[model samples]
Target: MKENILVIGGTGKTGRKVAHKLSKNGHLVRVGSRSGSPAFDWHKPEYWSLALQGMDKVYITFQPDLAVPGALNAIEALTKQAKNANIKKIVLLSGKGEREAELCEQVIIHSGIDYTIIRASWFNQNFSESFFLEPILEGFVALPQADIKVPYVDTEDISDVAVEALLNDKHNSKIYQLTGSRSLTFKEVINEISETTGRDIAFTPIAISAYTNMMKQQEVPDDFIWLVEYLFTEVLGNPNNSEITNDIEHVLGRKPKDISEYIKETAATGIWNS
Candidate 1:
């Protein structure tokens, strides 16, 4: 059945990809961004109704992260509005290691709407589109851990899964644990990208305190630094997330895109052509 789908955080990494895939497949896509028509701002509840208007399905990707303070309340409020608007289905992009994100998922589970939760691992695009990008470009990637391995899922893969969940009701009421087919340390990931691009990039593993000081020196906002620290100290320290999952293959019927492939494609796009 054809349905109207509104993509919240439509301009973000995964949300943009989800919106594009849905649009190309002929689903009616309404972008819910602060800049979109009938702008939607999660911080401003007034715009919620306008964004939910005329939509039967919603793909909700919270900005910053769902682990941030007050996310649960906002999610509860949004789910209520979705129910009020008669929206029958909802797909949420959540983090795998976040306990707070789990709270938000519970809100959707009991919302009486068809819900799909995509609890995703770290994104492969972090090296190209996020904090790690600049460090890679600078040839000096300083991070907190050298031995910790992560199952980093690509946003493209996540987007594909998200699109499937939204357009097909088969995934309704399912919680998918999405991860890359393999796990790699941050050093290993950087090495792979360096080999792909023929760039001599080096990974400098610093202490938690040292990394914090570096961020302070660069004048990164305190809250953002706190968030990163929380992720490294709390979430990354959790060992359960180190194992890879077949959820992507289970949903998309194929092996998830590998980090090497992602690096090659990103290099071809000139985004990492340093």
Candidate 2:
């Protein structure tokens, strides 16, 4: 069935891919961003209704993440607005191991609308498309996580699952925990990138407190600093985050891309070339 769909944070990592896939599949896709028509801003609730207007389904990718402070309230209010707009289905892109992310999931679960939750592990694009890019370019990546391994899933897989959930009613009311086929520590990840790009990139694992202080010295925003600390200390610190899952293969009917392939593909783009 053809339906109008709105993708909040439509320009972001997973959101962009979701929006693109939906648009390519003959669905009406409205990208909800501050720069989009009827501009949607998470901080500005007033724009939400306008973005929701005439939309039958929504793919939600909250700014920053749902683990940050005030995210629960924002999610609750947005769910209310989505309901009021008579939106039939909602697919939320969520974090895998964060408690606050679960609270936000509850908001959508009880939002009086059919919903699908894609609780995702860390993204492979973090190295090529996000904060890690600059560090990778500089030939030295510093972080607080060393021993912990992450089952970093690809945004392409995430988008595939989200698109499937949006187009299929069978996925409604389902919670999919998506992860890569295997786990890799930060050291192994850097080594993979080094091998792919043939560059001598270094990995430095600092203490959590030391990382926090470095971010402070760099003048990173307090909220961003808090999120970094929370991710390293709370999420990455948990052993459960290292577990690989078959959810991606179940959803897409194929194995998720490995980090090696991701590194090879990303390195070809010259994003990590130093």
Candidate 3:
């Protein structure tokens, strides 16, 4: 049964992959983004109804993060819009360790629409595609939470599970705490990437406060710094965050991609060195 799927933030790391896979699987995909027709912007709730129009299911990847302020309200309003649009299912990509993110998940769980929540660990792409990339490119990375082992999940696996949840009705109301098959600390993963690329990248472990101060010095946005601080202290600091989950295998019937694989493949893309 083919369906019309709207991927909000469709051009993003995980959303784009989900969109591509859905399209490849023959589902009609409408990319709901600021650039798309009937554009979807998080700040503008008015556009959401237009984007939700005519879509059967929606893959939602909230901007910044679910932990940020106003996210709960935005999610609540979006659920209403989705219901009005007659959207059948919604798959939300949420953070694994953040408590505030969990509060946002409550909105979807009770949204009265079929829903699946994927509580994901930190993404592997953070190193290759996002904030960590510049530091990696500089051959020097500095941060806090150096000792905590994070089961950093790949965006590929996250996308795969999200697509499966959307197409299959059995996943409705399921909250999958998605993590990798194993865990590694920031220092360990950086070492792997350095060895993989044969680059002499250095890793420094500082206090969370010190790390935030560094960001402040660099003029990183205050909200972003707050998020970083919250994640490093409140989220990553949680002991349960390091626990490995078989949710990916439980859904996809295979082991989640290891950070090593991400390092090798991402290194191949030269994003790390570039």
Candidate 4:
């Protein structure tokens, strides 16, 4: 059954992929962004109803992250609005192992509407598509994390799961913990990229305080700096976050993409060639 769907943050990493898949499958997709038609902005609740109006389902990928402050309230408000708009289902992109993210998930779980939570580990695209891209291009990656291995799930896998959840009722009320088949440390990640791209990229481990100070010196936004500190110290610091899950295989009947494959594919794009 084809339905009208709204993809919040539709231009973002996972949301863009999700919107593309849904649209290709003959579902009507409304991209919810500050620049989208009807203009949905998280900081501005008044814009939400216009975006939700007439949509049968919504795919929510919150900006920054749900782990940040004020995210819980925003999510709760949006869930209520979506429910009130009579949207039948919602698929939320969430973070794994973050307590605050879990609290936001609870909001949707009890929102009186059918919902699916795709709880994910770090995205592999952070190197190719996000803030880390510049560092990768500069031939050096500096961060506060070291010795810790991350499962680094691919956004393509995330998109596949999100599309499945939106189109199928079986996924409703389900929480899928998504991760790569194996864990890799930052050093390993850099080495793979260096080998794949034939570029001499280097990884530098720094203290959390030093990382924070550097970002502050660079005049990064305070909220973003806070989020970075929170993730480095709170999320990555936990050993349990490194556990791999078969939820991707369970949902799509296929193994998740590995980091090596991701490196090869991304390297071919020449994004890291610098």
For candidate 2, write residues 1-274 as lDDT tens digits.
Answer: 7779999989999889989988888899999999999999888998789999999999999879899989999999999999899999999999999989999999999888999999999999988888788888898888888889899999999999999999899999999999998998999999989988989999998899998998899999999999989998889987889988899888889999998899888888887774
Taking all chains together, each candidate's TM-score versus the true structure is 0.97, 0.98, 0.98, 0.98
Off by over 4 Å in 1: none
Better of 1 and 4 by TM-score: 4
lDDT of 3 by residue, 121-205 (tens): 9999999778998999998999887888999999999999999999998999999999988899999999999999999999999
lDDT per prediction?
0.91, 0.91, 0.92, 0.93
Counted clashes in each candidate structure: 0, 0, 0, 0
Question: What overall lDDT, based on C-alpha atoms, would model 4 receive against the true structure?
Answer: 0.93
Cα distance off (Å), candidate 4, residue 234: 0.9
- Which pairs clash (backbone N, Cα, C closer than 3 Å) in model 4? none
Q: In candidate 4, which residue ranges exceed 4 Å CA deviation? A: none
**What TM-score does candidate 4 get on C-alpha atoms?**
0.98
Window of ten residues with lowest summed lDDT in model 3:
265-274
What digit string (tens of lDDT, one per residue) describes model 1 on residues 1-274? Answer: 6679999999999999998988888889999999998899988997899889999999999978888887899999999999999998999999998888999999999989999999999999999999999988888898997789999999999999999999888999999999998889999999988888888999988899999989999999987887898788777888978978899999999999998888889989877775
Q: How displaced is residue 73 in candidate 4, in Å?
A: 1.2
Across residues 84-158, which tens digit of lDDT does each residue of candidate 4 receive? Answer: 899999999999888889999999998889999999999999989888899889998888788899999999999
